[model samples]
Target: MSNSMKVSFCCKDCKRKMFDYYAGILNLYIKCNRCKRVLTLKKIDEKYVAERMINGKLFV
Candidate 1:
């Protein structure tokens, strides 16, 4: 019964959450707190309720 969707982000190398909130504004230039790895997030739809990982090698 939630109107807002929750999109999660994780570290590709460590598989840990990048932020505390499940959903929030995405910043392309991000550093994973757990792994200390830099990540670039894509602009995905807000309706998606799943985690999307950026590998820096995929073609959108």
Candidate 2:
């Protein structure tokens, strides 16, 4: 199995909620699916990262 990082996207201009995608935190950037904006995933929370790296289910 491959390990991937978790990420969320937000718009730069509108600050609107955008996307959540498989992305590595070590990487400098990720693209927003909704707004098509480029953003740094580092701005997102660590809890999301913890959840992403875990087991088959992220929720109960």
Candidate 3:
């Protein structure tokens, strides 16, 4: 079986959850649906994904 896990992303500005389900961690850029802010999927730990928000802040 693959090790990729399904996870959801939340917009830091609006705190709104995105609609799509992403599998595995990606060091890529994504836009927030609500705030239209660009963010990076920074890392994926054992159980959660960490995201970098528009304010240069990290959130889990």
lDDT for every model?
0.49, 0.49, 0.52
RMSD of each: 6.7, 7.8, 7.0
Model 1 clash tally, residue pairs:
0
Model 1 Cα lDDT, one tens digit per residue, 1-60: 144533345566887766433444444678867668887666544333232323312111
lDDT of 2 by residue, 1-60 (tens): 234644444465655655554634444575656557676644534556565533432321
What candidate 1 gets wrong by more than 4 Å, as runs, is 1-3, 20-27, 42-60
**Could you tell me which 10 consecutive residues in candidate 2 have the lowest summed lDDT?**
51-60
Reference-based lDDT, residue 14, model 1: 81
Provide the global lDDT of candidate 1 against the true structure. 0.49
lDDT leader: 3
Structural similarity to truth (TM-score) of each candidate = 0.46, 0.29, 0.45
Question: What's model 3's TM-score?
Answer: 0.45
**lDDT of model 2, residue 45:** 41
Clash pairs of candidate 2?
A: none
- Score candidate 3 by lDDT: 0.52
